[model samples]
Target: MSAMLHPISRRLFLSGAAALGGVVMLHPFAARASANQAHLRLMETTDLHVHVFPYDYYADRPNDTMGLARTAAIIDGIRAEAGNSMLIDNGDFLQGNPMGDYIAYQRGMKDGDMHPIISAMNTLGYECSTLGNHEFNYGLDFMFKVLAGANFPFVCANLTKGSLAANARDDALFIKPYVILDKTITDGAGQDHPIRVGLIGFVPPQIMNWDARHLTGKAMTRDIVKAAEAWVPQMREEGADIVIALSHSGVGPAQYEENLENASLHLAGVDGIDAIVTGHSHLDFPGPKFEGMEGVDNAKGTIGGKPAVMGGFWGSHLGLIDLMLERDGKNWRVSASTSEARPIFERVDRKAKPLVESKAEVEDAARDMHEATLAYVRTAVGKTAAPLHSYFALVADDPSVQIVSQAQTWYIADMLSETEHKDLPVLSAAAPFKAGGRGGPDYYTDVPAGDIAIKNVADLYLYPNTVQAVLVTGAQVKDWLEMSAGIFNQVEPGKADQTLINTEFPSYNFDVIDGVTYRIDLAQPPKYDPKGNLINEGANRIVALEFDGKPIDPEQKFVVASNNYRAGGGGNFPDIGPDKVIFQAPDTNRDVIVRFIVEQGTINPAADANWSFAPVDGATVLFETGPKAKDFIADVKGVAIEAAGDGADGFAQYRITL
Candidate 1:
């Protein structure tokens, strides 16, 4: 029988040779672990984001918190502990950090070129992988080039080559939707057995909205749950004994919604799937984040009665799933399953310390490429007069986000020259991508006053979202800001020392619309929830909104320049759906910001202070930011910000006089 790697004294590998007393055999699956029951181990690394080495190119320092090389140590240790194992990556492996930018912008993937991330994963001997949304950031040609060099099969059941009308089928996939591997396994009492293990993959359907520029006419996507339901049943008919799903999605509500971003929970409920691997949320499964979630056992890492796991992004964690399978006549049935996430670093004294060092071979795989990437990001592109920082972006008008808004407004004004919306006032909505929420305290942007490099641009704008313009009335504009105001927690009039920031709300969703002035009323409840659902139907948090010196006319029309994500129902803002979208620029927000900085040399960094917190009598709210906020506390407008003390997770506590 055809076989892959042989068992070496009970240690299994992925090569195609078997050795007995140091003598090689034709078939590697000759040894047996048990006669009736065979144990299978699965290791997953998701959202790698091209972190091949133990380094932070943005900070230009060695960071132990993330790296595929660091996670390789844990992978090796876990593989050593198991009898039979297979490694898989759940996607989001293409873009995120400086390394990814370097590959896309500097090193351009040619036909034969090996992507550094793929090169690193190749050395790790990955069995299979799926495409993430970020994979299309560089375009289809580049992704096809990267996939050409991958040793393992790439699968995505949702992404198809044809249009939506074609209906996604196994034959219509851009890549293979699923693969049934005729794996040979050993059972108890030294008996070799054959089993067909099916592996299917699914990415979020939002790729159409996120990377519409690269995927509009050529490709389309189907709903995750719908794709899994159609494909898993076909996999069973194709002689698959055990089926495992590689879901490049996040776990959310159990009730299925069409086009929902997070659909792993519902995908796991599909009948034929034996186990599931989840990602794209940049979170770990079985952690505190999933605690109390419906149909999820955090302790056992099971979702909808199926074993599931989501390894954290940037190689921070290695997801592990163990299955006990028993042979039943001609097929293998999963009897028991367990899952966990193993971190490469542990927090010590509010700092990350490497619990597992980088593996030697993994480091050797991409050392030269890593050094080249660092050099590429360090090249000076422009200069900044004042320091660009986002420590207090949420509390006050920030220069970092202000600069992006300024650039967007400038770009949109030029693009609207001949358009019908040219006469209408153009407002730019910019959000703080790195205000240190789930990203931790060190995640805030801190670019010093000097030459701005490509790394600074990457830090300034984290996402590769494209620039888009949404046309709406003044009333819809106010509703948009009201939705953004949900980032702040409601404070009582007489409440002192109350938390000012809503920790549950992501800083990225807190859009600060430039080209207008407004006040966020903390005394009033938010009109919308963090997910953009209208909760407080009649609640009004935005007060005294003005385009110039006068109150904004509710009936007046305006054009708001923002990213594609916001315009494509990402934040659930009212009247800002795709139908209202008037302008869709192919340029990414990062590129637009970079071009703006280059054009206006030696520009002022001072924020225009368009927004502020309205007065709440007898209220003194306290919030936490990076410790470096102490340097520019006085520059903050409207609010009275005072340094209280050091807060948890290396954040600085600040008191806000409202």
Candidate 2:
């Protein structure tokens, strides 16, 4: 592999890893190769989120489906067959797992300290990278300290910083807006030639809104398309042959929205771009998952007439874009392109088998930091009287979310005590982040009864969203619950053995509000869509809502403690927006839960059973949860989840009777 690679090689460290050999191109663009031609393979790993090992730090177990170490092997596997290759990360490498938290909070990133993920990436030999929204989770100072340890250049055309206030100038960029690489590569005909490859990067402008604490008055963002239009032309004027966009954004609507979070599709429409490496959505492009989408040719891997690819998140897949280039008057133009994601493990008959082994060198690079992270996460934070689990989070009142709700409410109560809203009732809303869904059955959280560690807190709450409190009227609260009810499929009163959960509604969107009691009537349609738009204005799934034994008043205002995402219009719930946000806590929800556990010492991990489905005669619905849920069936308070059978992917099928 090293012999075939150029000096600017992609997989120098991958010594003996075997490529899967089968290259399935979901979308193939036709290429007319000429005598003077070269093949450049662009490899991308997006949303790594600090996953360097095939290990789940939250679960404290070795997982088969994640890690950059494993993806490094695949990079070795594929780069051996290509003439020239360049490795790039599309962003979100900083914060996700317990390792990230440990590095940020436990072991501070000082002047000389190296982040484990960056160390692993440096070992893998990444050419360039970009920033994701989560990069700012711990604050800018920490983010920059971590970035300083990276061996590769990090670029983002949209994210800019200046001594001056917010502006739209590309010159104000904190990092280089774009990097031009001068490289010599071997062509398909075994001839050496020089090529100037322009690499420009972009991040979602929503980072300002998402990470307001870190970005306010310090950094500003421009629209992705605007950044691309401004910078791609400049890169060309600097004598670049081809421009590749390291778009740390997701593929979404074709039509451009100024400062849109997911703007990769529209960014590709910008002239002067050859190809795009997209991320931030945690989905694979050119896969059937994106089939039949507007302005996207999934089969051809082209968005807006340009080759594009989005590698799956957490280093699950390495995005491969093979471009066929022909020399045209001392410049190279792409004649054809093909893109696909190569997974570390392949699933056959719903069972995953390892396709590539973890590169020992990469693993060795991260071993020291990995051990420290494990020790940090394993430190006992508190104790749980009952099991801190989420296997039954969707079907019943979950102890996992309950503890988070308790923590948020506890934190917000003190924050509001001196304020005018102190007299008003406080409600906390939390969601089950690990409930079985597209992540499959093993995705559910199951923290055993005993000492609870910081790792357990991560399992209880997966996101890094900070605590936020919003003031809303009773009517708005009802509407919020109605929006949450969209997680369920409308069930006929007399139906039997019907699927009840709406697979489209993410488990994280199913907010369980504490302090107020309500019942979800499954027979009625959801008042709001999953995105929180009022679809059926008159529909009300929240049959009965009461506070302190009294029915909720539409005019009365109450403060609901929740995450920043929810208060910042994430769920699009009615009367919930940045304007309505009354309090913004600096601590992340995960930290709040940790603090709550510490303060309590020995905490009761029990849901109060404040919410449940309204009983309907002769109604039976089927749902699936992690197989571990069977052990705690008797502990569920409100819902009757009778074990029906063993479900696919190691799930336990349950029949809910009403």
TM-score list, all predictions: 0.72, 0.74
Candidate 2 lDDT over 1-658, as tens digits, reads 1233344244432342244444422112212333578778899999998899999876678888899999988777656555478999999999877788777877788898888889999987788998888888899999899899999999988877744323334257888988988877676556777788889998888777666657889988888888788878889999989999999887877767788888988888899999999998778888997888888898889888799898898889999898988888799999888888877887888877877788898899889989988897788867999998888888778899899899999989877776788898899999999887878878877888888898777677887688999999999989888999999988987889999888888888899999999899988888887877778888888978999888989899899999889998887878789899887664578877876888899999688899998998889999998888889899999987699998887778999998
Deviating ranges (above 4 Å) for candidate 1: 4-34, 164-171, 385-398, 407-450, 457-513, 518-544, 553-606, 609-658
Q: Candidate 2: where are CA atoms >4 Å away?
A: 1-17, 21-34, 163-170, 383-398, 407-450, 457-512, 519-544, 547-550, 553-658
Q: What is the lDDT, from 0 to 100, of the residue 211 in candidate 1?
A: 70
Model 2 residue pairs with clashes: 27-299, 27-300
Which lDDT values do the candidates have, in the order given? Answer: 0.83, 0.83
lDDT of 1: 0.83
TM-score of 2: 0.74
